[model samples]
Target: MAHRTRPLNLAVPALAVLLLALVLAPLAAVGWRGAGLSLGPADWSAVRFSVTQALLSSLFSTLLAIPVARALARRRFPGRGLLITLMGAPFLLPAVVAVLGLLAIFGRSGLLNSALQALSLPPISIYGLHGVVLAHIFLNLPLATRMILQGWLAIPAERIRLAQSLGFGPAETFRHLEAPMLREVLPGVALVIMVVCLTSFAVVITLGGGPKATTIELAIYQAVRFEFDLGRAAALAGVQVAVGAVAALAAWTFARPAGFGAGLDRGLPLSAPGGWRRGADSVALLAATLFLTLPLIAVFLRGLPGLADLPASVLPAASRSVLVALTSAALTTGIALTLALAAASRPRPLIEAAATLPLATSGLVLGTGLFLLIQPFTTPMTLALPITILVNCALSLPYLYRILLPETRALHADYGRLADSLSLTGWPRLRWLVLPRLARPLGFGAGVAAALSMGDLGVIALFAGESQATLPLVVAQLTGAYRMEAAASAALILVTLSFALFWACDAGGRRAAA
Candidate 1:
């Protein structure tokens, strides 16, 4: 027992210490500085606005997902797989690019407005609370649909077979089967979307249009950049974390593993509902596809024309972003593997929590702490890319850990005794057994980390000088300057690079596994 556990004892403690210094210490800095901070009316307003929008965004996203998810589950259309794949595209999408795409369709001279004008009706605005909610819905609806669809898919064929044999109609099947599944799924979906919208900065900053639409994250940025008020920024960070913790706890309490039963390859053959029900499904599917696909098409169309006039800065920024993303992918994968291995060897709550703690800490808040921490020793601008790399590593850890943990446990459970009996331990066991078994998930986690880091705007915005900026930051700068053509071109480049990296890594993993 002593020999078997020795490595884990050392590795787990070391990981915990690293997380403390790198992740927790910085958050503590925020809490420490904001200890005496007090909120004014404006600060309170930001809080109210942040909570209100998040609630509305999550509510709408989850409610809208029910019908869409149900339609996708039962109906096997020609392009069904492609549409499902596209659902995940929004996750890898850079926020700035999404904003540009949305504007092309919803802006004053955009499709809807033009149609309204042609009909002699007043063109509506896309720059207030509704605008923010609209953007959130566009972004999160896919996520909610995917989650609910996963739940639908997990329902056993036997239960479905029973329902069909009992001559249950659509209403009865829904009441008995689908509604229960949704009840199990929607809470977690809402919680996830709520947390995402809670810390949303780029979307609100761009679409918010003014102070009245500001979220807590935007308020923090304002305090730091305009007021130079660390106290106010820290105070807002505190509120953000408090709100995130409450939501997270609620999710943890209510959340169950969505996995119910393994799919048996053959689907449950149920009778299709006809008439208006079918039409409603068709409308839902068509509207969703057009809404999501149009913006991407616009980005490509708008960007193609501007590529010839691309700026010189785009290349350098792209290079820097690639470098940071690669480095962060390596760092995050390494840390997540180490922590996952340690926990798999022997579970420790503190070590596990430390890995996930960053999820609750906003990226801008982490950048702010790092800025304060390193400002005394050297120029923050000089260390901008490195700091960004580190923050990305911290932010990506939780996802990587989630991917690795289950795989690690399964590997150990299956092979631990056998490996020990064969006297295969330490590096050889991991190299031969664990690594081979885990390559696919590891590669997937690395890809996700890479893509996420490639498009991250939070840390870079805080630390970037005029000369040092990532691709996302560069795109945002162009948009701020109203250089729409140049911005669209840069966004295309950003999206391409992000997707390419993810594809290469994910495909490589599949090849290795095969």
Candidate 2:
């Protein structure tokens, strides 16, 4: 007991402390400055706008996610596996990539507009409140779908079979059985989306042409940093953080990192309903597919034509992104493994909670903290590549912890007694037993970290000087400079590279687990 339990307790907390310190830096900055800070009406307005847009985005995305998740859970179809994988893509898809893809399709010169011009109809506007919501749904719909399907997985097969035998129709089963699971899981999906929207910068920046549409995050950048109104920027940060914290708390409350799904029997055909329900599910799923995929399709179509116009700058920018991704992956994996190992035992509600804090605190926020932290010790913070990597490490930790903690908990719960009985402990137990058992999830954790790092725009945006620019940052720069074609090409390459990297890492982990 002493040998096995003591090391586990000591290590987990130590690792957790390191991870927590990094996440706390942002809150610490604002609080360290003091509570007497005042936000003007403008700052309050940004908060109100943030909440409104995020609510709209979350409500619409979740409502849309339901039918698709049900179809994926309730119906058998070809290409289902591929669709589920794509549903998880936004978790790694950089905000910049989605923004560029959206602009090509929805922008005035974009496909929809071109079609509108040909038919002499009023073109759809892609800037303002509508654009922010559009981009949010584009990123979140698939995520919410995946989460709901996972909830569907929680319904016992026997429970499902019994429900059918009792003559409960599909509608009844969904209402009684699936509805509860949705109730349970909806908070998690909504909370995740809300925090994401609160921290929104890139979405608002690219799409926000007018003052009315600005988010607190974008407003902060304009007011304090770019506009050089340090007082207003500081004021906005206080309001933003307060609002973000409230949303963060809500997210934490609804945080079922491990969620409940209704029921699914893999590859088994679900009982079908006639007419309206079936027709509705099919139609809704189709709309979601098109809504999510069309812009991405446009990225390829519009960007490919301009591939020849890809800046000579791309080769170097892409090169730097790859280096950053590789380094961030390795570093993120190391931190994940260490903290995961530390949290392997203990009741880690706090550490687990801390893991997700970075989700609320944007890369821009963290980068700002890191910039302030390092400024006394360094020149233009972007020049310090090592600090940028550290920011990436912090940014990627939440996904890594989420991926690793579940498996870690299971590993310890199931294996701890066995190892303690054997008097096996520390590296011996971990190497010989626990590590072997958890290889697949740990690798998945690593892959997730790497993929997210590859796509991250937050820290990189702040630290990416021309000399140190990452792919996502370079893509943003191109779009801003109106080198739209080059931006699109870079967006495609960035997305492809991130997916490939995740796949390779995850495959290796799975192979190792096997």
Candidate 3:
């Protein structure tokens, strides 16, 4: 039996080591390359802006989501399930696409501005610090709402019954049952959004620029692309790594589990007060739905006309993106599954850390470090796609690992003894036991990874030469050149491809599981 398991044991650690190397090696290169460099005033400004915007974005996203989530938790309106599903779309929506959507509604000549102009009011600018915050909120509010709603759902129905038995009013109910969940969940949600915004590149680059609005990620890009300052870029990357690590650690430390005991799986609903509260909840739902969906509708509507006149570069760029997305999805799924399976058998901090450490590093930071590491030997452009693939895998691995770990652990707990008794080792075990059991999460994770890669505009921008551009890059290029119609067209294609890849992988997994 030991002989049969020896290969599995060895493979787990070997894979862990490779993952650690992938994450740490580039960081080491960054540190070594920027050993003596000091950040200038501009770099300091970038750091400040990054931290400030991230905090503000997180605060607003969490605060705004509370009412929306509470409404969803208690309200059983029609289309409620569909609305919940819609929340996930913005999270998967490409940063470039979301920015374009925002521009369509809020830009100088966009719908809102047009209305203002018709009333003879001054037009608003969707560029600078405020724009950055608005865009972040737009992208992250849904995520915050979803997380909080899950917290609301996880509160055992018995608790709601107890509160109702006591004749608790809405305020009393919130004071006792709901607020505690928010206390437990909000910190984590805010921190997650903060970390996400801290590492934001595409959004900041598109909507927020200049010295006042630039984030560390943007400054790193400027250092590499515009200034050709590798040392400065490395220094900025190191700062980013520090900030990300600190935020991640804070999230882990602060996010305590709610000690709400379990209840029988009853389908009791929370107290949904009527009168003004009902009206308010309806308003919240309506506002949230519009805020989330309008940009997507605008993207479709604007892009519809330009579809027949897409730039020649869009098709080829999209093909490159699909290739990258598929490849990244495969690699991420394989690595995430291995790590999850290994961690399920025992507590492997090294494996777990390797799986998550990428969260503490942005794509541009990884790209910068990789560029520095690779430049001494060859041009970074020569290996752009491969590096992008690797970075996407690293970035996407954490999500898949998180998704798979719980299921993997549950599987092991339920079937490990039986599998061992039967000597279900090697390929047969995986084929008959593991794969069959874990197909759904594996599919969903792969879909997420694919969609994310499809919409990625980060590392590729740093490394891609003209010929190697992806769809997101193509869209950004078109937007940059003031080709709004073409950019919208390419962005629409990018969104379609991303969602399709996600659906295909996810559906395939669901079918296999069935």
Candidate 4:
């Protein structure tokens, strides 16, 4: 399924040069000390701690999601679409926002604690390993559920109908039909969770009390941002990259193409269960929804009044955020599309990997790395707008790829042969055969990139000054200044903008996909 009519050209190489310039900002800043560092016992201990936590979190998140997903997939109910949308909402949130929401639900003065005090029970701590795991689960459970639900959706309905027609009992049907689908999806779920948890920074930092809960990304952050120990940060980052590369590659093996199931080949009708199975499923669904949503509700309640008194600075901050998101979205999409186009039918894993390299390191690590790399050269604040935009673009490539690759593959699959046969290659082919076909995915990716960059707090963290601050950066500043109301107001605004951007882009994509 490869197109060979046209020879490779300069798009990716040229864009890669630009991408490399931006992506390598940190490595260039920290280059002198790169070779001087080595992984020692302390680094190994941090790695051990991070790996264990990620494994436990991944296992727990995936296992817990199974029942939730199974319940959603197997049962019928009112408001199911709403439930599904809520489940998918976490994927759209910034990790910091989700962490905050989790804190509101699970922290000392949280709902759980209020319930405990009514019974006069001892208060539980919401810091350290337990809290980190809880936050990750809260954010990722829905993701795992969606992935598994996709698997459930993949089960050809005809197969299920055949079993029913053969008078197979419910238990027998599940064993023969459902079990295989779950097994096929399990590794992908685990691997994705492991990769995500490995890169945990915001959650670990917010929830981590001290050494006992330390993750490697947090270690890298402290080493650079707090301690200014470029040497230690480099060592830990290197270790993280090495370990993460292995895990990512393993996950890549299990990673199948997205959009596996269409509502074609239908047979069995999907519906809800009854009796004890129904009650148990209903209860699980209710608790999962509550745990997933209550913290956001708390944030809403806390911020409702505060929205009126939002700092005069917030509007300007918001203005800056939108401008930055626009620039970044354009840049990210341009870079992503160029790479995807240039790489349309070539062997370019290195180029692909380089474009996506930003995801391996946490934003804290990236910010610090870029800070060190760019400091001897220039103040990041001098180019704060562009630098933050680039970082967000780089960080969001994997998501962009989630859209681009599929559309590209499908376009190539359907018409590439004919186009090549007719010798309609290069821009002509791209303009007609490719772009029109991929409009939906590219637009969708752009929308996600825009929405995600809108809520970013990472690059701005390194570059923030009074003269320049995005809304999330402003929110962080408000939190640092102990203006809880202002921070809440900022968070609310940030969420709204984030949601709107995602919705618009996704809507456009859907229209295009249609």
- CA RMSD, predictions in order: 2.2, 3.2, 1.2, 4.0
Residue 82, model 2: Cα distance from true site in angstroms:
1.6
User: Each model's TM-score, in the order given?
Assistant: 0.95, 0.89, 0.98, 0.86
User: Where does candidate 2 clash, by residue pair?
Assistant: 12-342, 151-260, 151-261, 151-262, 152-261, 152-262, 152-263, 154-261, 155-262
Pairs in steric clash, model 1: none
Instruction: Give the lDDT of residue 451 in candidate 2.
Output: 78
TM-score of 3: 0.98
How far in Å is the alpha carbon of 493 misplaced in model 2?
1.5
Query: Candidate order by lDDT, highest to lowest?
Result: 3, 1, 2, 4
- The sequence of per-residue lDDT tens digits that candidate 3 reaches over residues 95-175 is 999999999999877899999999999999989989999999999999999999888988998898889999999999999
For candidate 1, which ten residues in a row score worst on lDDT? Answer: 263-272
Deviating ranges (above 4 Å) for candidate 3: none
Better of 2 and 3 by lDDT: 3
Tens digits of per-residue lDDT, candidate 4, 1-514, equal 1354324454456667766666566655444456676766766778988998888888899999988888988876799989998887877776666766765667776778888989999988888888888888987899999998888777767676777788776577678877877767888888888988898766776777366778887777667657777788776766677677788888778867333354457635434557887888888899899888787877777777888777888999899999988788888887777677656666587667766776555555566667676677886678777778767887887678656865666677778779868888767887877767887787778888888888776657656777788887777667546566566767788888888887887788678657
List the global CA lDDT of all models: 0.85, 0.76, 0.92, 0.75
Q: How do the residues 1-514 of candidate 2 rate in per-residue lDDT, one tens digit apiece?
A: 4865677667666767776788687657645543577777776777778888999999888888988998888766788788888888887888888998888888978989999999999999889899999999999898889887877766777677777889998778878777877888888888878877878777888887456887877776675446655446555666776777788888778867333333355433346676898898789778877877888888887678777777877878777777878898888887677677667777567666666666666666665555555556776444646766777788778778777877877888998778778988767887898778988987787777777777776655655567777788788888889888889999989888888888888898889889
The model with the greatest TM-score is: 3
Candidate 1 versus the native: TM-score?
Answer: 0.95
The candidate with the higher TM-score, 2 or 3, is: 3
Task: Name the regions of candidate 1 deviating beyond 4 angstroms.
Answer: 1-8, 257-270
Residue 182's lDDT in candidate 2:
82
